[model samples]
Target: MIPMRMPWRQGDVLDLASIGSRVDSLTDLSTIDGGPGARLTAVRTQAQAFRREFIETGTPDSVTTCDLVTLPYPTRFGLFRASRAIAPFLAITNRLLVIRWHESDGTPRVLLFEPSDVELGRYTPYFDKLAGRTPDVVSKRMVTEHATVLTHLARLRIDPSEVDYLMFDHLHTQDLRRWIGTTAPQPDLGEQPTPVFPRAKVIVQRDELAAMADLHPLQRPWYQPGTYRDVPPEAFLPIDGSVVLGPGVAVVKTPGHVFGNQSLVLNTATGVWVSSENVIAAECLTPEHSRMPGLARWAREWGQEVVLNANTIETTVDQYNSIVLEKTLADRSQRDSRFLQFFPSSELTASWTNPGTSPTFTHGAIAHH
Candidate 1:
C-alpha cells in the first residue's frame, strides 16, 4: 500500500511526462533561462497556464491548516511601512499545511508544507536574539503553546511514514536535520536525530540551495547554515522551476524574500490559494481595505499590489514581482471577496496588545471540503 501510494520514485527521471501535471518542474528553474528578465516572463507565463488548468478547475482531497505554534515577529518586517502603528512585535502563527491530493491514476498522496521543528529553528541567530530583546511585557516562551509536526500528524490521523514530501516556502529559520535526519551525530539532538518522516522526499528550490551555500552578510542572520549542512543529500528533492506536485498544487518560484523563495499554490473547494511568507498579512495583498495606519496609503502612492515582507533587500524587485505573480495566480477570498486568497504560511494575527497594528482582514483558517 505504501509503495503503491507514492507518486515519485528515488531514481525516477522527472521528465515532463513523469511529473504528471504537464507543468515545468525542474531543479534548475532559476538558472536564468535567458537572463533575469526572460526568466520572470517565462515564470509568469507558466503560472497563468498552471492556474487555468490546475488551480481553477480541481479540488484536492482537502487542505487542512493546523496551528503548530505562535510567536512574535517584528512589525516592520510584517509590513513594508508600518508607520507609527506599533512598536517592535506582533503575534504570528505558523501553520502546518496538510495537503492531500491524488495522482491522475487516483492514488492518494500527502504533502506537509512547513513542518517546522521549533527546537532546531531557534538556531537562527536573528530569531534567537528576539527572545532576549522582546519587552518584559512579552512572555519568554516565544509562543503561547508549541507542538511538533508529528503531534499535529497524530491529531489529523496522518501516519508519519506515509507523507510523500516535506517542504518550506524558504529556508529561513528552518532546521531540517530532525525531520530528515543528519549524516553525522551532533550535540543538537545528542546524536543524529532519527527521521520523523522517513519516506518523505524533502522538496526544495535549487536556487535556495545556492543562496544557502553563498550567503550574503544580510542573509546570514536569518539562516542557520550549520544546521542544514549535515543533512544527507539524498533526503532532498530539489527542483529548479515551477512544478505541479499533484492536482491543484504547484510549487511556484517567488524569489525576493530570499533568492530561492517559493510559494505553495493549491486549488481547494472554495478557490485558488497561494501560501508563502512573501507577505505576512492579508492586507498586504489588498491594501485598499487595510485599516493599519499608512499601509493602504503607501500602496496607493506606489501603485503596489502587495507590500513586501522586506526583511532582506537582496532581490527586492524580484520579490515584489513574485508577490504580484502570486496575487495574479490566486482567487479572491471566499470568506471576503475583497481580498485575494494568498495565505501567509506564517500569518500575522490580531492582538490588542499590538495596538493600531492588526491586519485589515484575517481568514482565520482556509475553508475546504
Candidate 2:
C-alpha cells in the first residue's frame, strides 16, 4: 500500500451538529446595500462564525434518507487522464448529481450539483476534434435520452421548480444564468434569460463568488463571462464554511482545487455520501498497495497527494488537506468495514461497471419515504 498519512484516528467522527445554526447566522447579502467590499466583509464574518461554531459542537443529527440521481453528460476521458493509451480517444460520461433529502421538519428539498447544459455546446472543446461536431451533438442526444437531469427528475415526477437549491463544488465553466435566469437582456434574445428552476436558491461560497467577480487571467477561460453579473442578490444563498441544508445534508468547505471548493455531505441508508469533484473516481481513494493503474497509478508513482482536476489547483497543500479530510470522513461513515462510500459529483464512467468503487449508482433509488 502506498503509505499515506491518515489525518484522523479510525474512530474519530466529523462534528456537524452546529452547522444549521452557523448557516442561519450568515448575513443575508440582499440586505446589504454596499458594493463588493461589503459583500466580502459579510463573507469573512460568516466564515469566522462557522469555524467558531464547529469548534463548539459535535456531529449533527442524521437524516432518514439521502437519495442521489446521476445525470450523465458527454465528455472525453482525457479530461480525467485515466490512462494515456485510451485517454485521448475514449468518450466517457461527465456525471452530475441531484440530491434529495428531508429537513428536520420533514420538508422535501432538492439540490442540483454541477448540473450542465451540454445542449448549449459549453463542453465542445473537451471532445476529440477528429470526431468532429457530430460527437458533441451525439453525446448531447445520448445524455438527454438516457440520463439528463430533467429526464431523471421527470421519471421521479419531481418538478424543476420544486428544487430548493443549486450548487457547484467550484465554479469552472458554469453558466448559472442559464439555469436561474438573468435580470439583463440577453444578446441573443434581447430579453431576460429564463430561469430553469424558478424557485430554487443558488448556494455558492462567498469566496468563490468573489473570485468569479475578479477571476485571474488563467481562470477566466474556464468560466462563462457575465453569467452571474445580472443575477439578483436575493437568488443567492452564500455561505462561508460548513452549513447544514437539513438534518442530514450539509455543504462543507473542502478547498484545494479552488479556494471556494466545497463538498456535499449526506447521511444516507448506505452511508455518508460526499459529492465533490476533488477525486475524479473511487479508484483514487483506494489503498496504494491495491494495484491501481492509469491516473491512480501515476499518482502513486509521482507521490502526488491526490488526483485532482488539472485546471483547478490553487495550492497542493490545501488540496492534500481537503482530500485527507474527505477520505477520513468517508472512512468514519462506512456502513461496512470492507469499503468507503464517498460520491464524486462528476462521476467517472469506469465507476458504473467497476465494483469496490467509492460511490456506485446501479442500486440507487429516489426513496419517497
Predicted model with the maximum lDDT: 1
Candidate 1 regions exceeding 4 Å error are 1-46, 134-137
Tens digits of per-residue lDDT, candidate 2, 1-369, equal: 222221112333323342254456544443667764565455556544643444333333332222232323222222234343322322234455666666666776777776665444353233223335456774444332235567657865779989888888886756666677877787754678878888887777776766665666656546654555576666777666768766556687777677788887665555455667776555455534223335446666776534554454575455555665566555332333433565655555443223323232221222323
Give the clashing pairs for model 1: 26-240, 27-239, 27-240, 28-240, 29-240, 29-241
TM-score of each: 0.88, 0.67
Tens-digit per-residue lDDT, 1-369, candidate 1:
111111223344444444444354323335655766676676567567667777544778888888877887788877867445755778888988898977878788899998898777866899778766666566654465566788889998999988988889998998888788877797857887888888888787777776677677888888877776677777777676677778787887787888888899888777788999998887788888888888878878877667888888778877877887788788888777889888898898877667767777887677575
Q: Candidate 2, TM-score vs. the true structure?
A: 0.67
Poorly placed runs, candidate 2 (over 4 Å) = 1-19, 23-86, 89-92, 121-145, 287-305, 332-339, 350-369
lDDT for each candidate structure: 0.77, 0.55
RMSD, every candidate, angstroms: 6.0, 11.6
Q: Evaluate model 1: give its TM-score.
A: 0.88
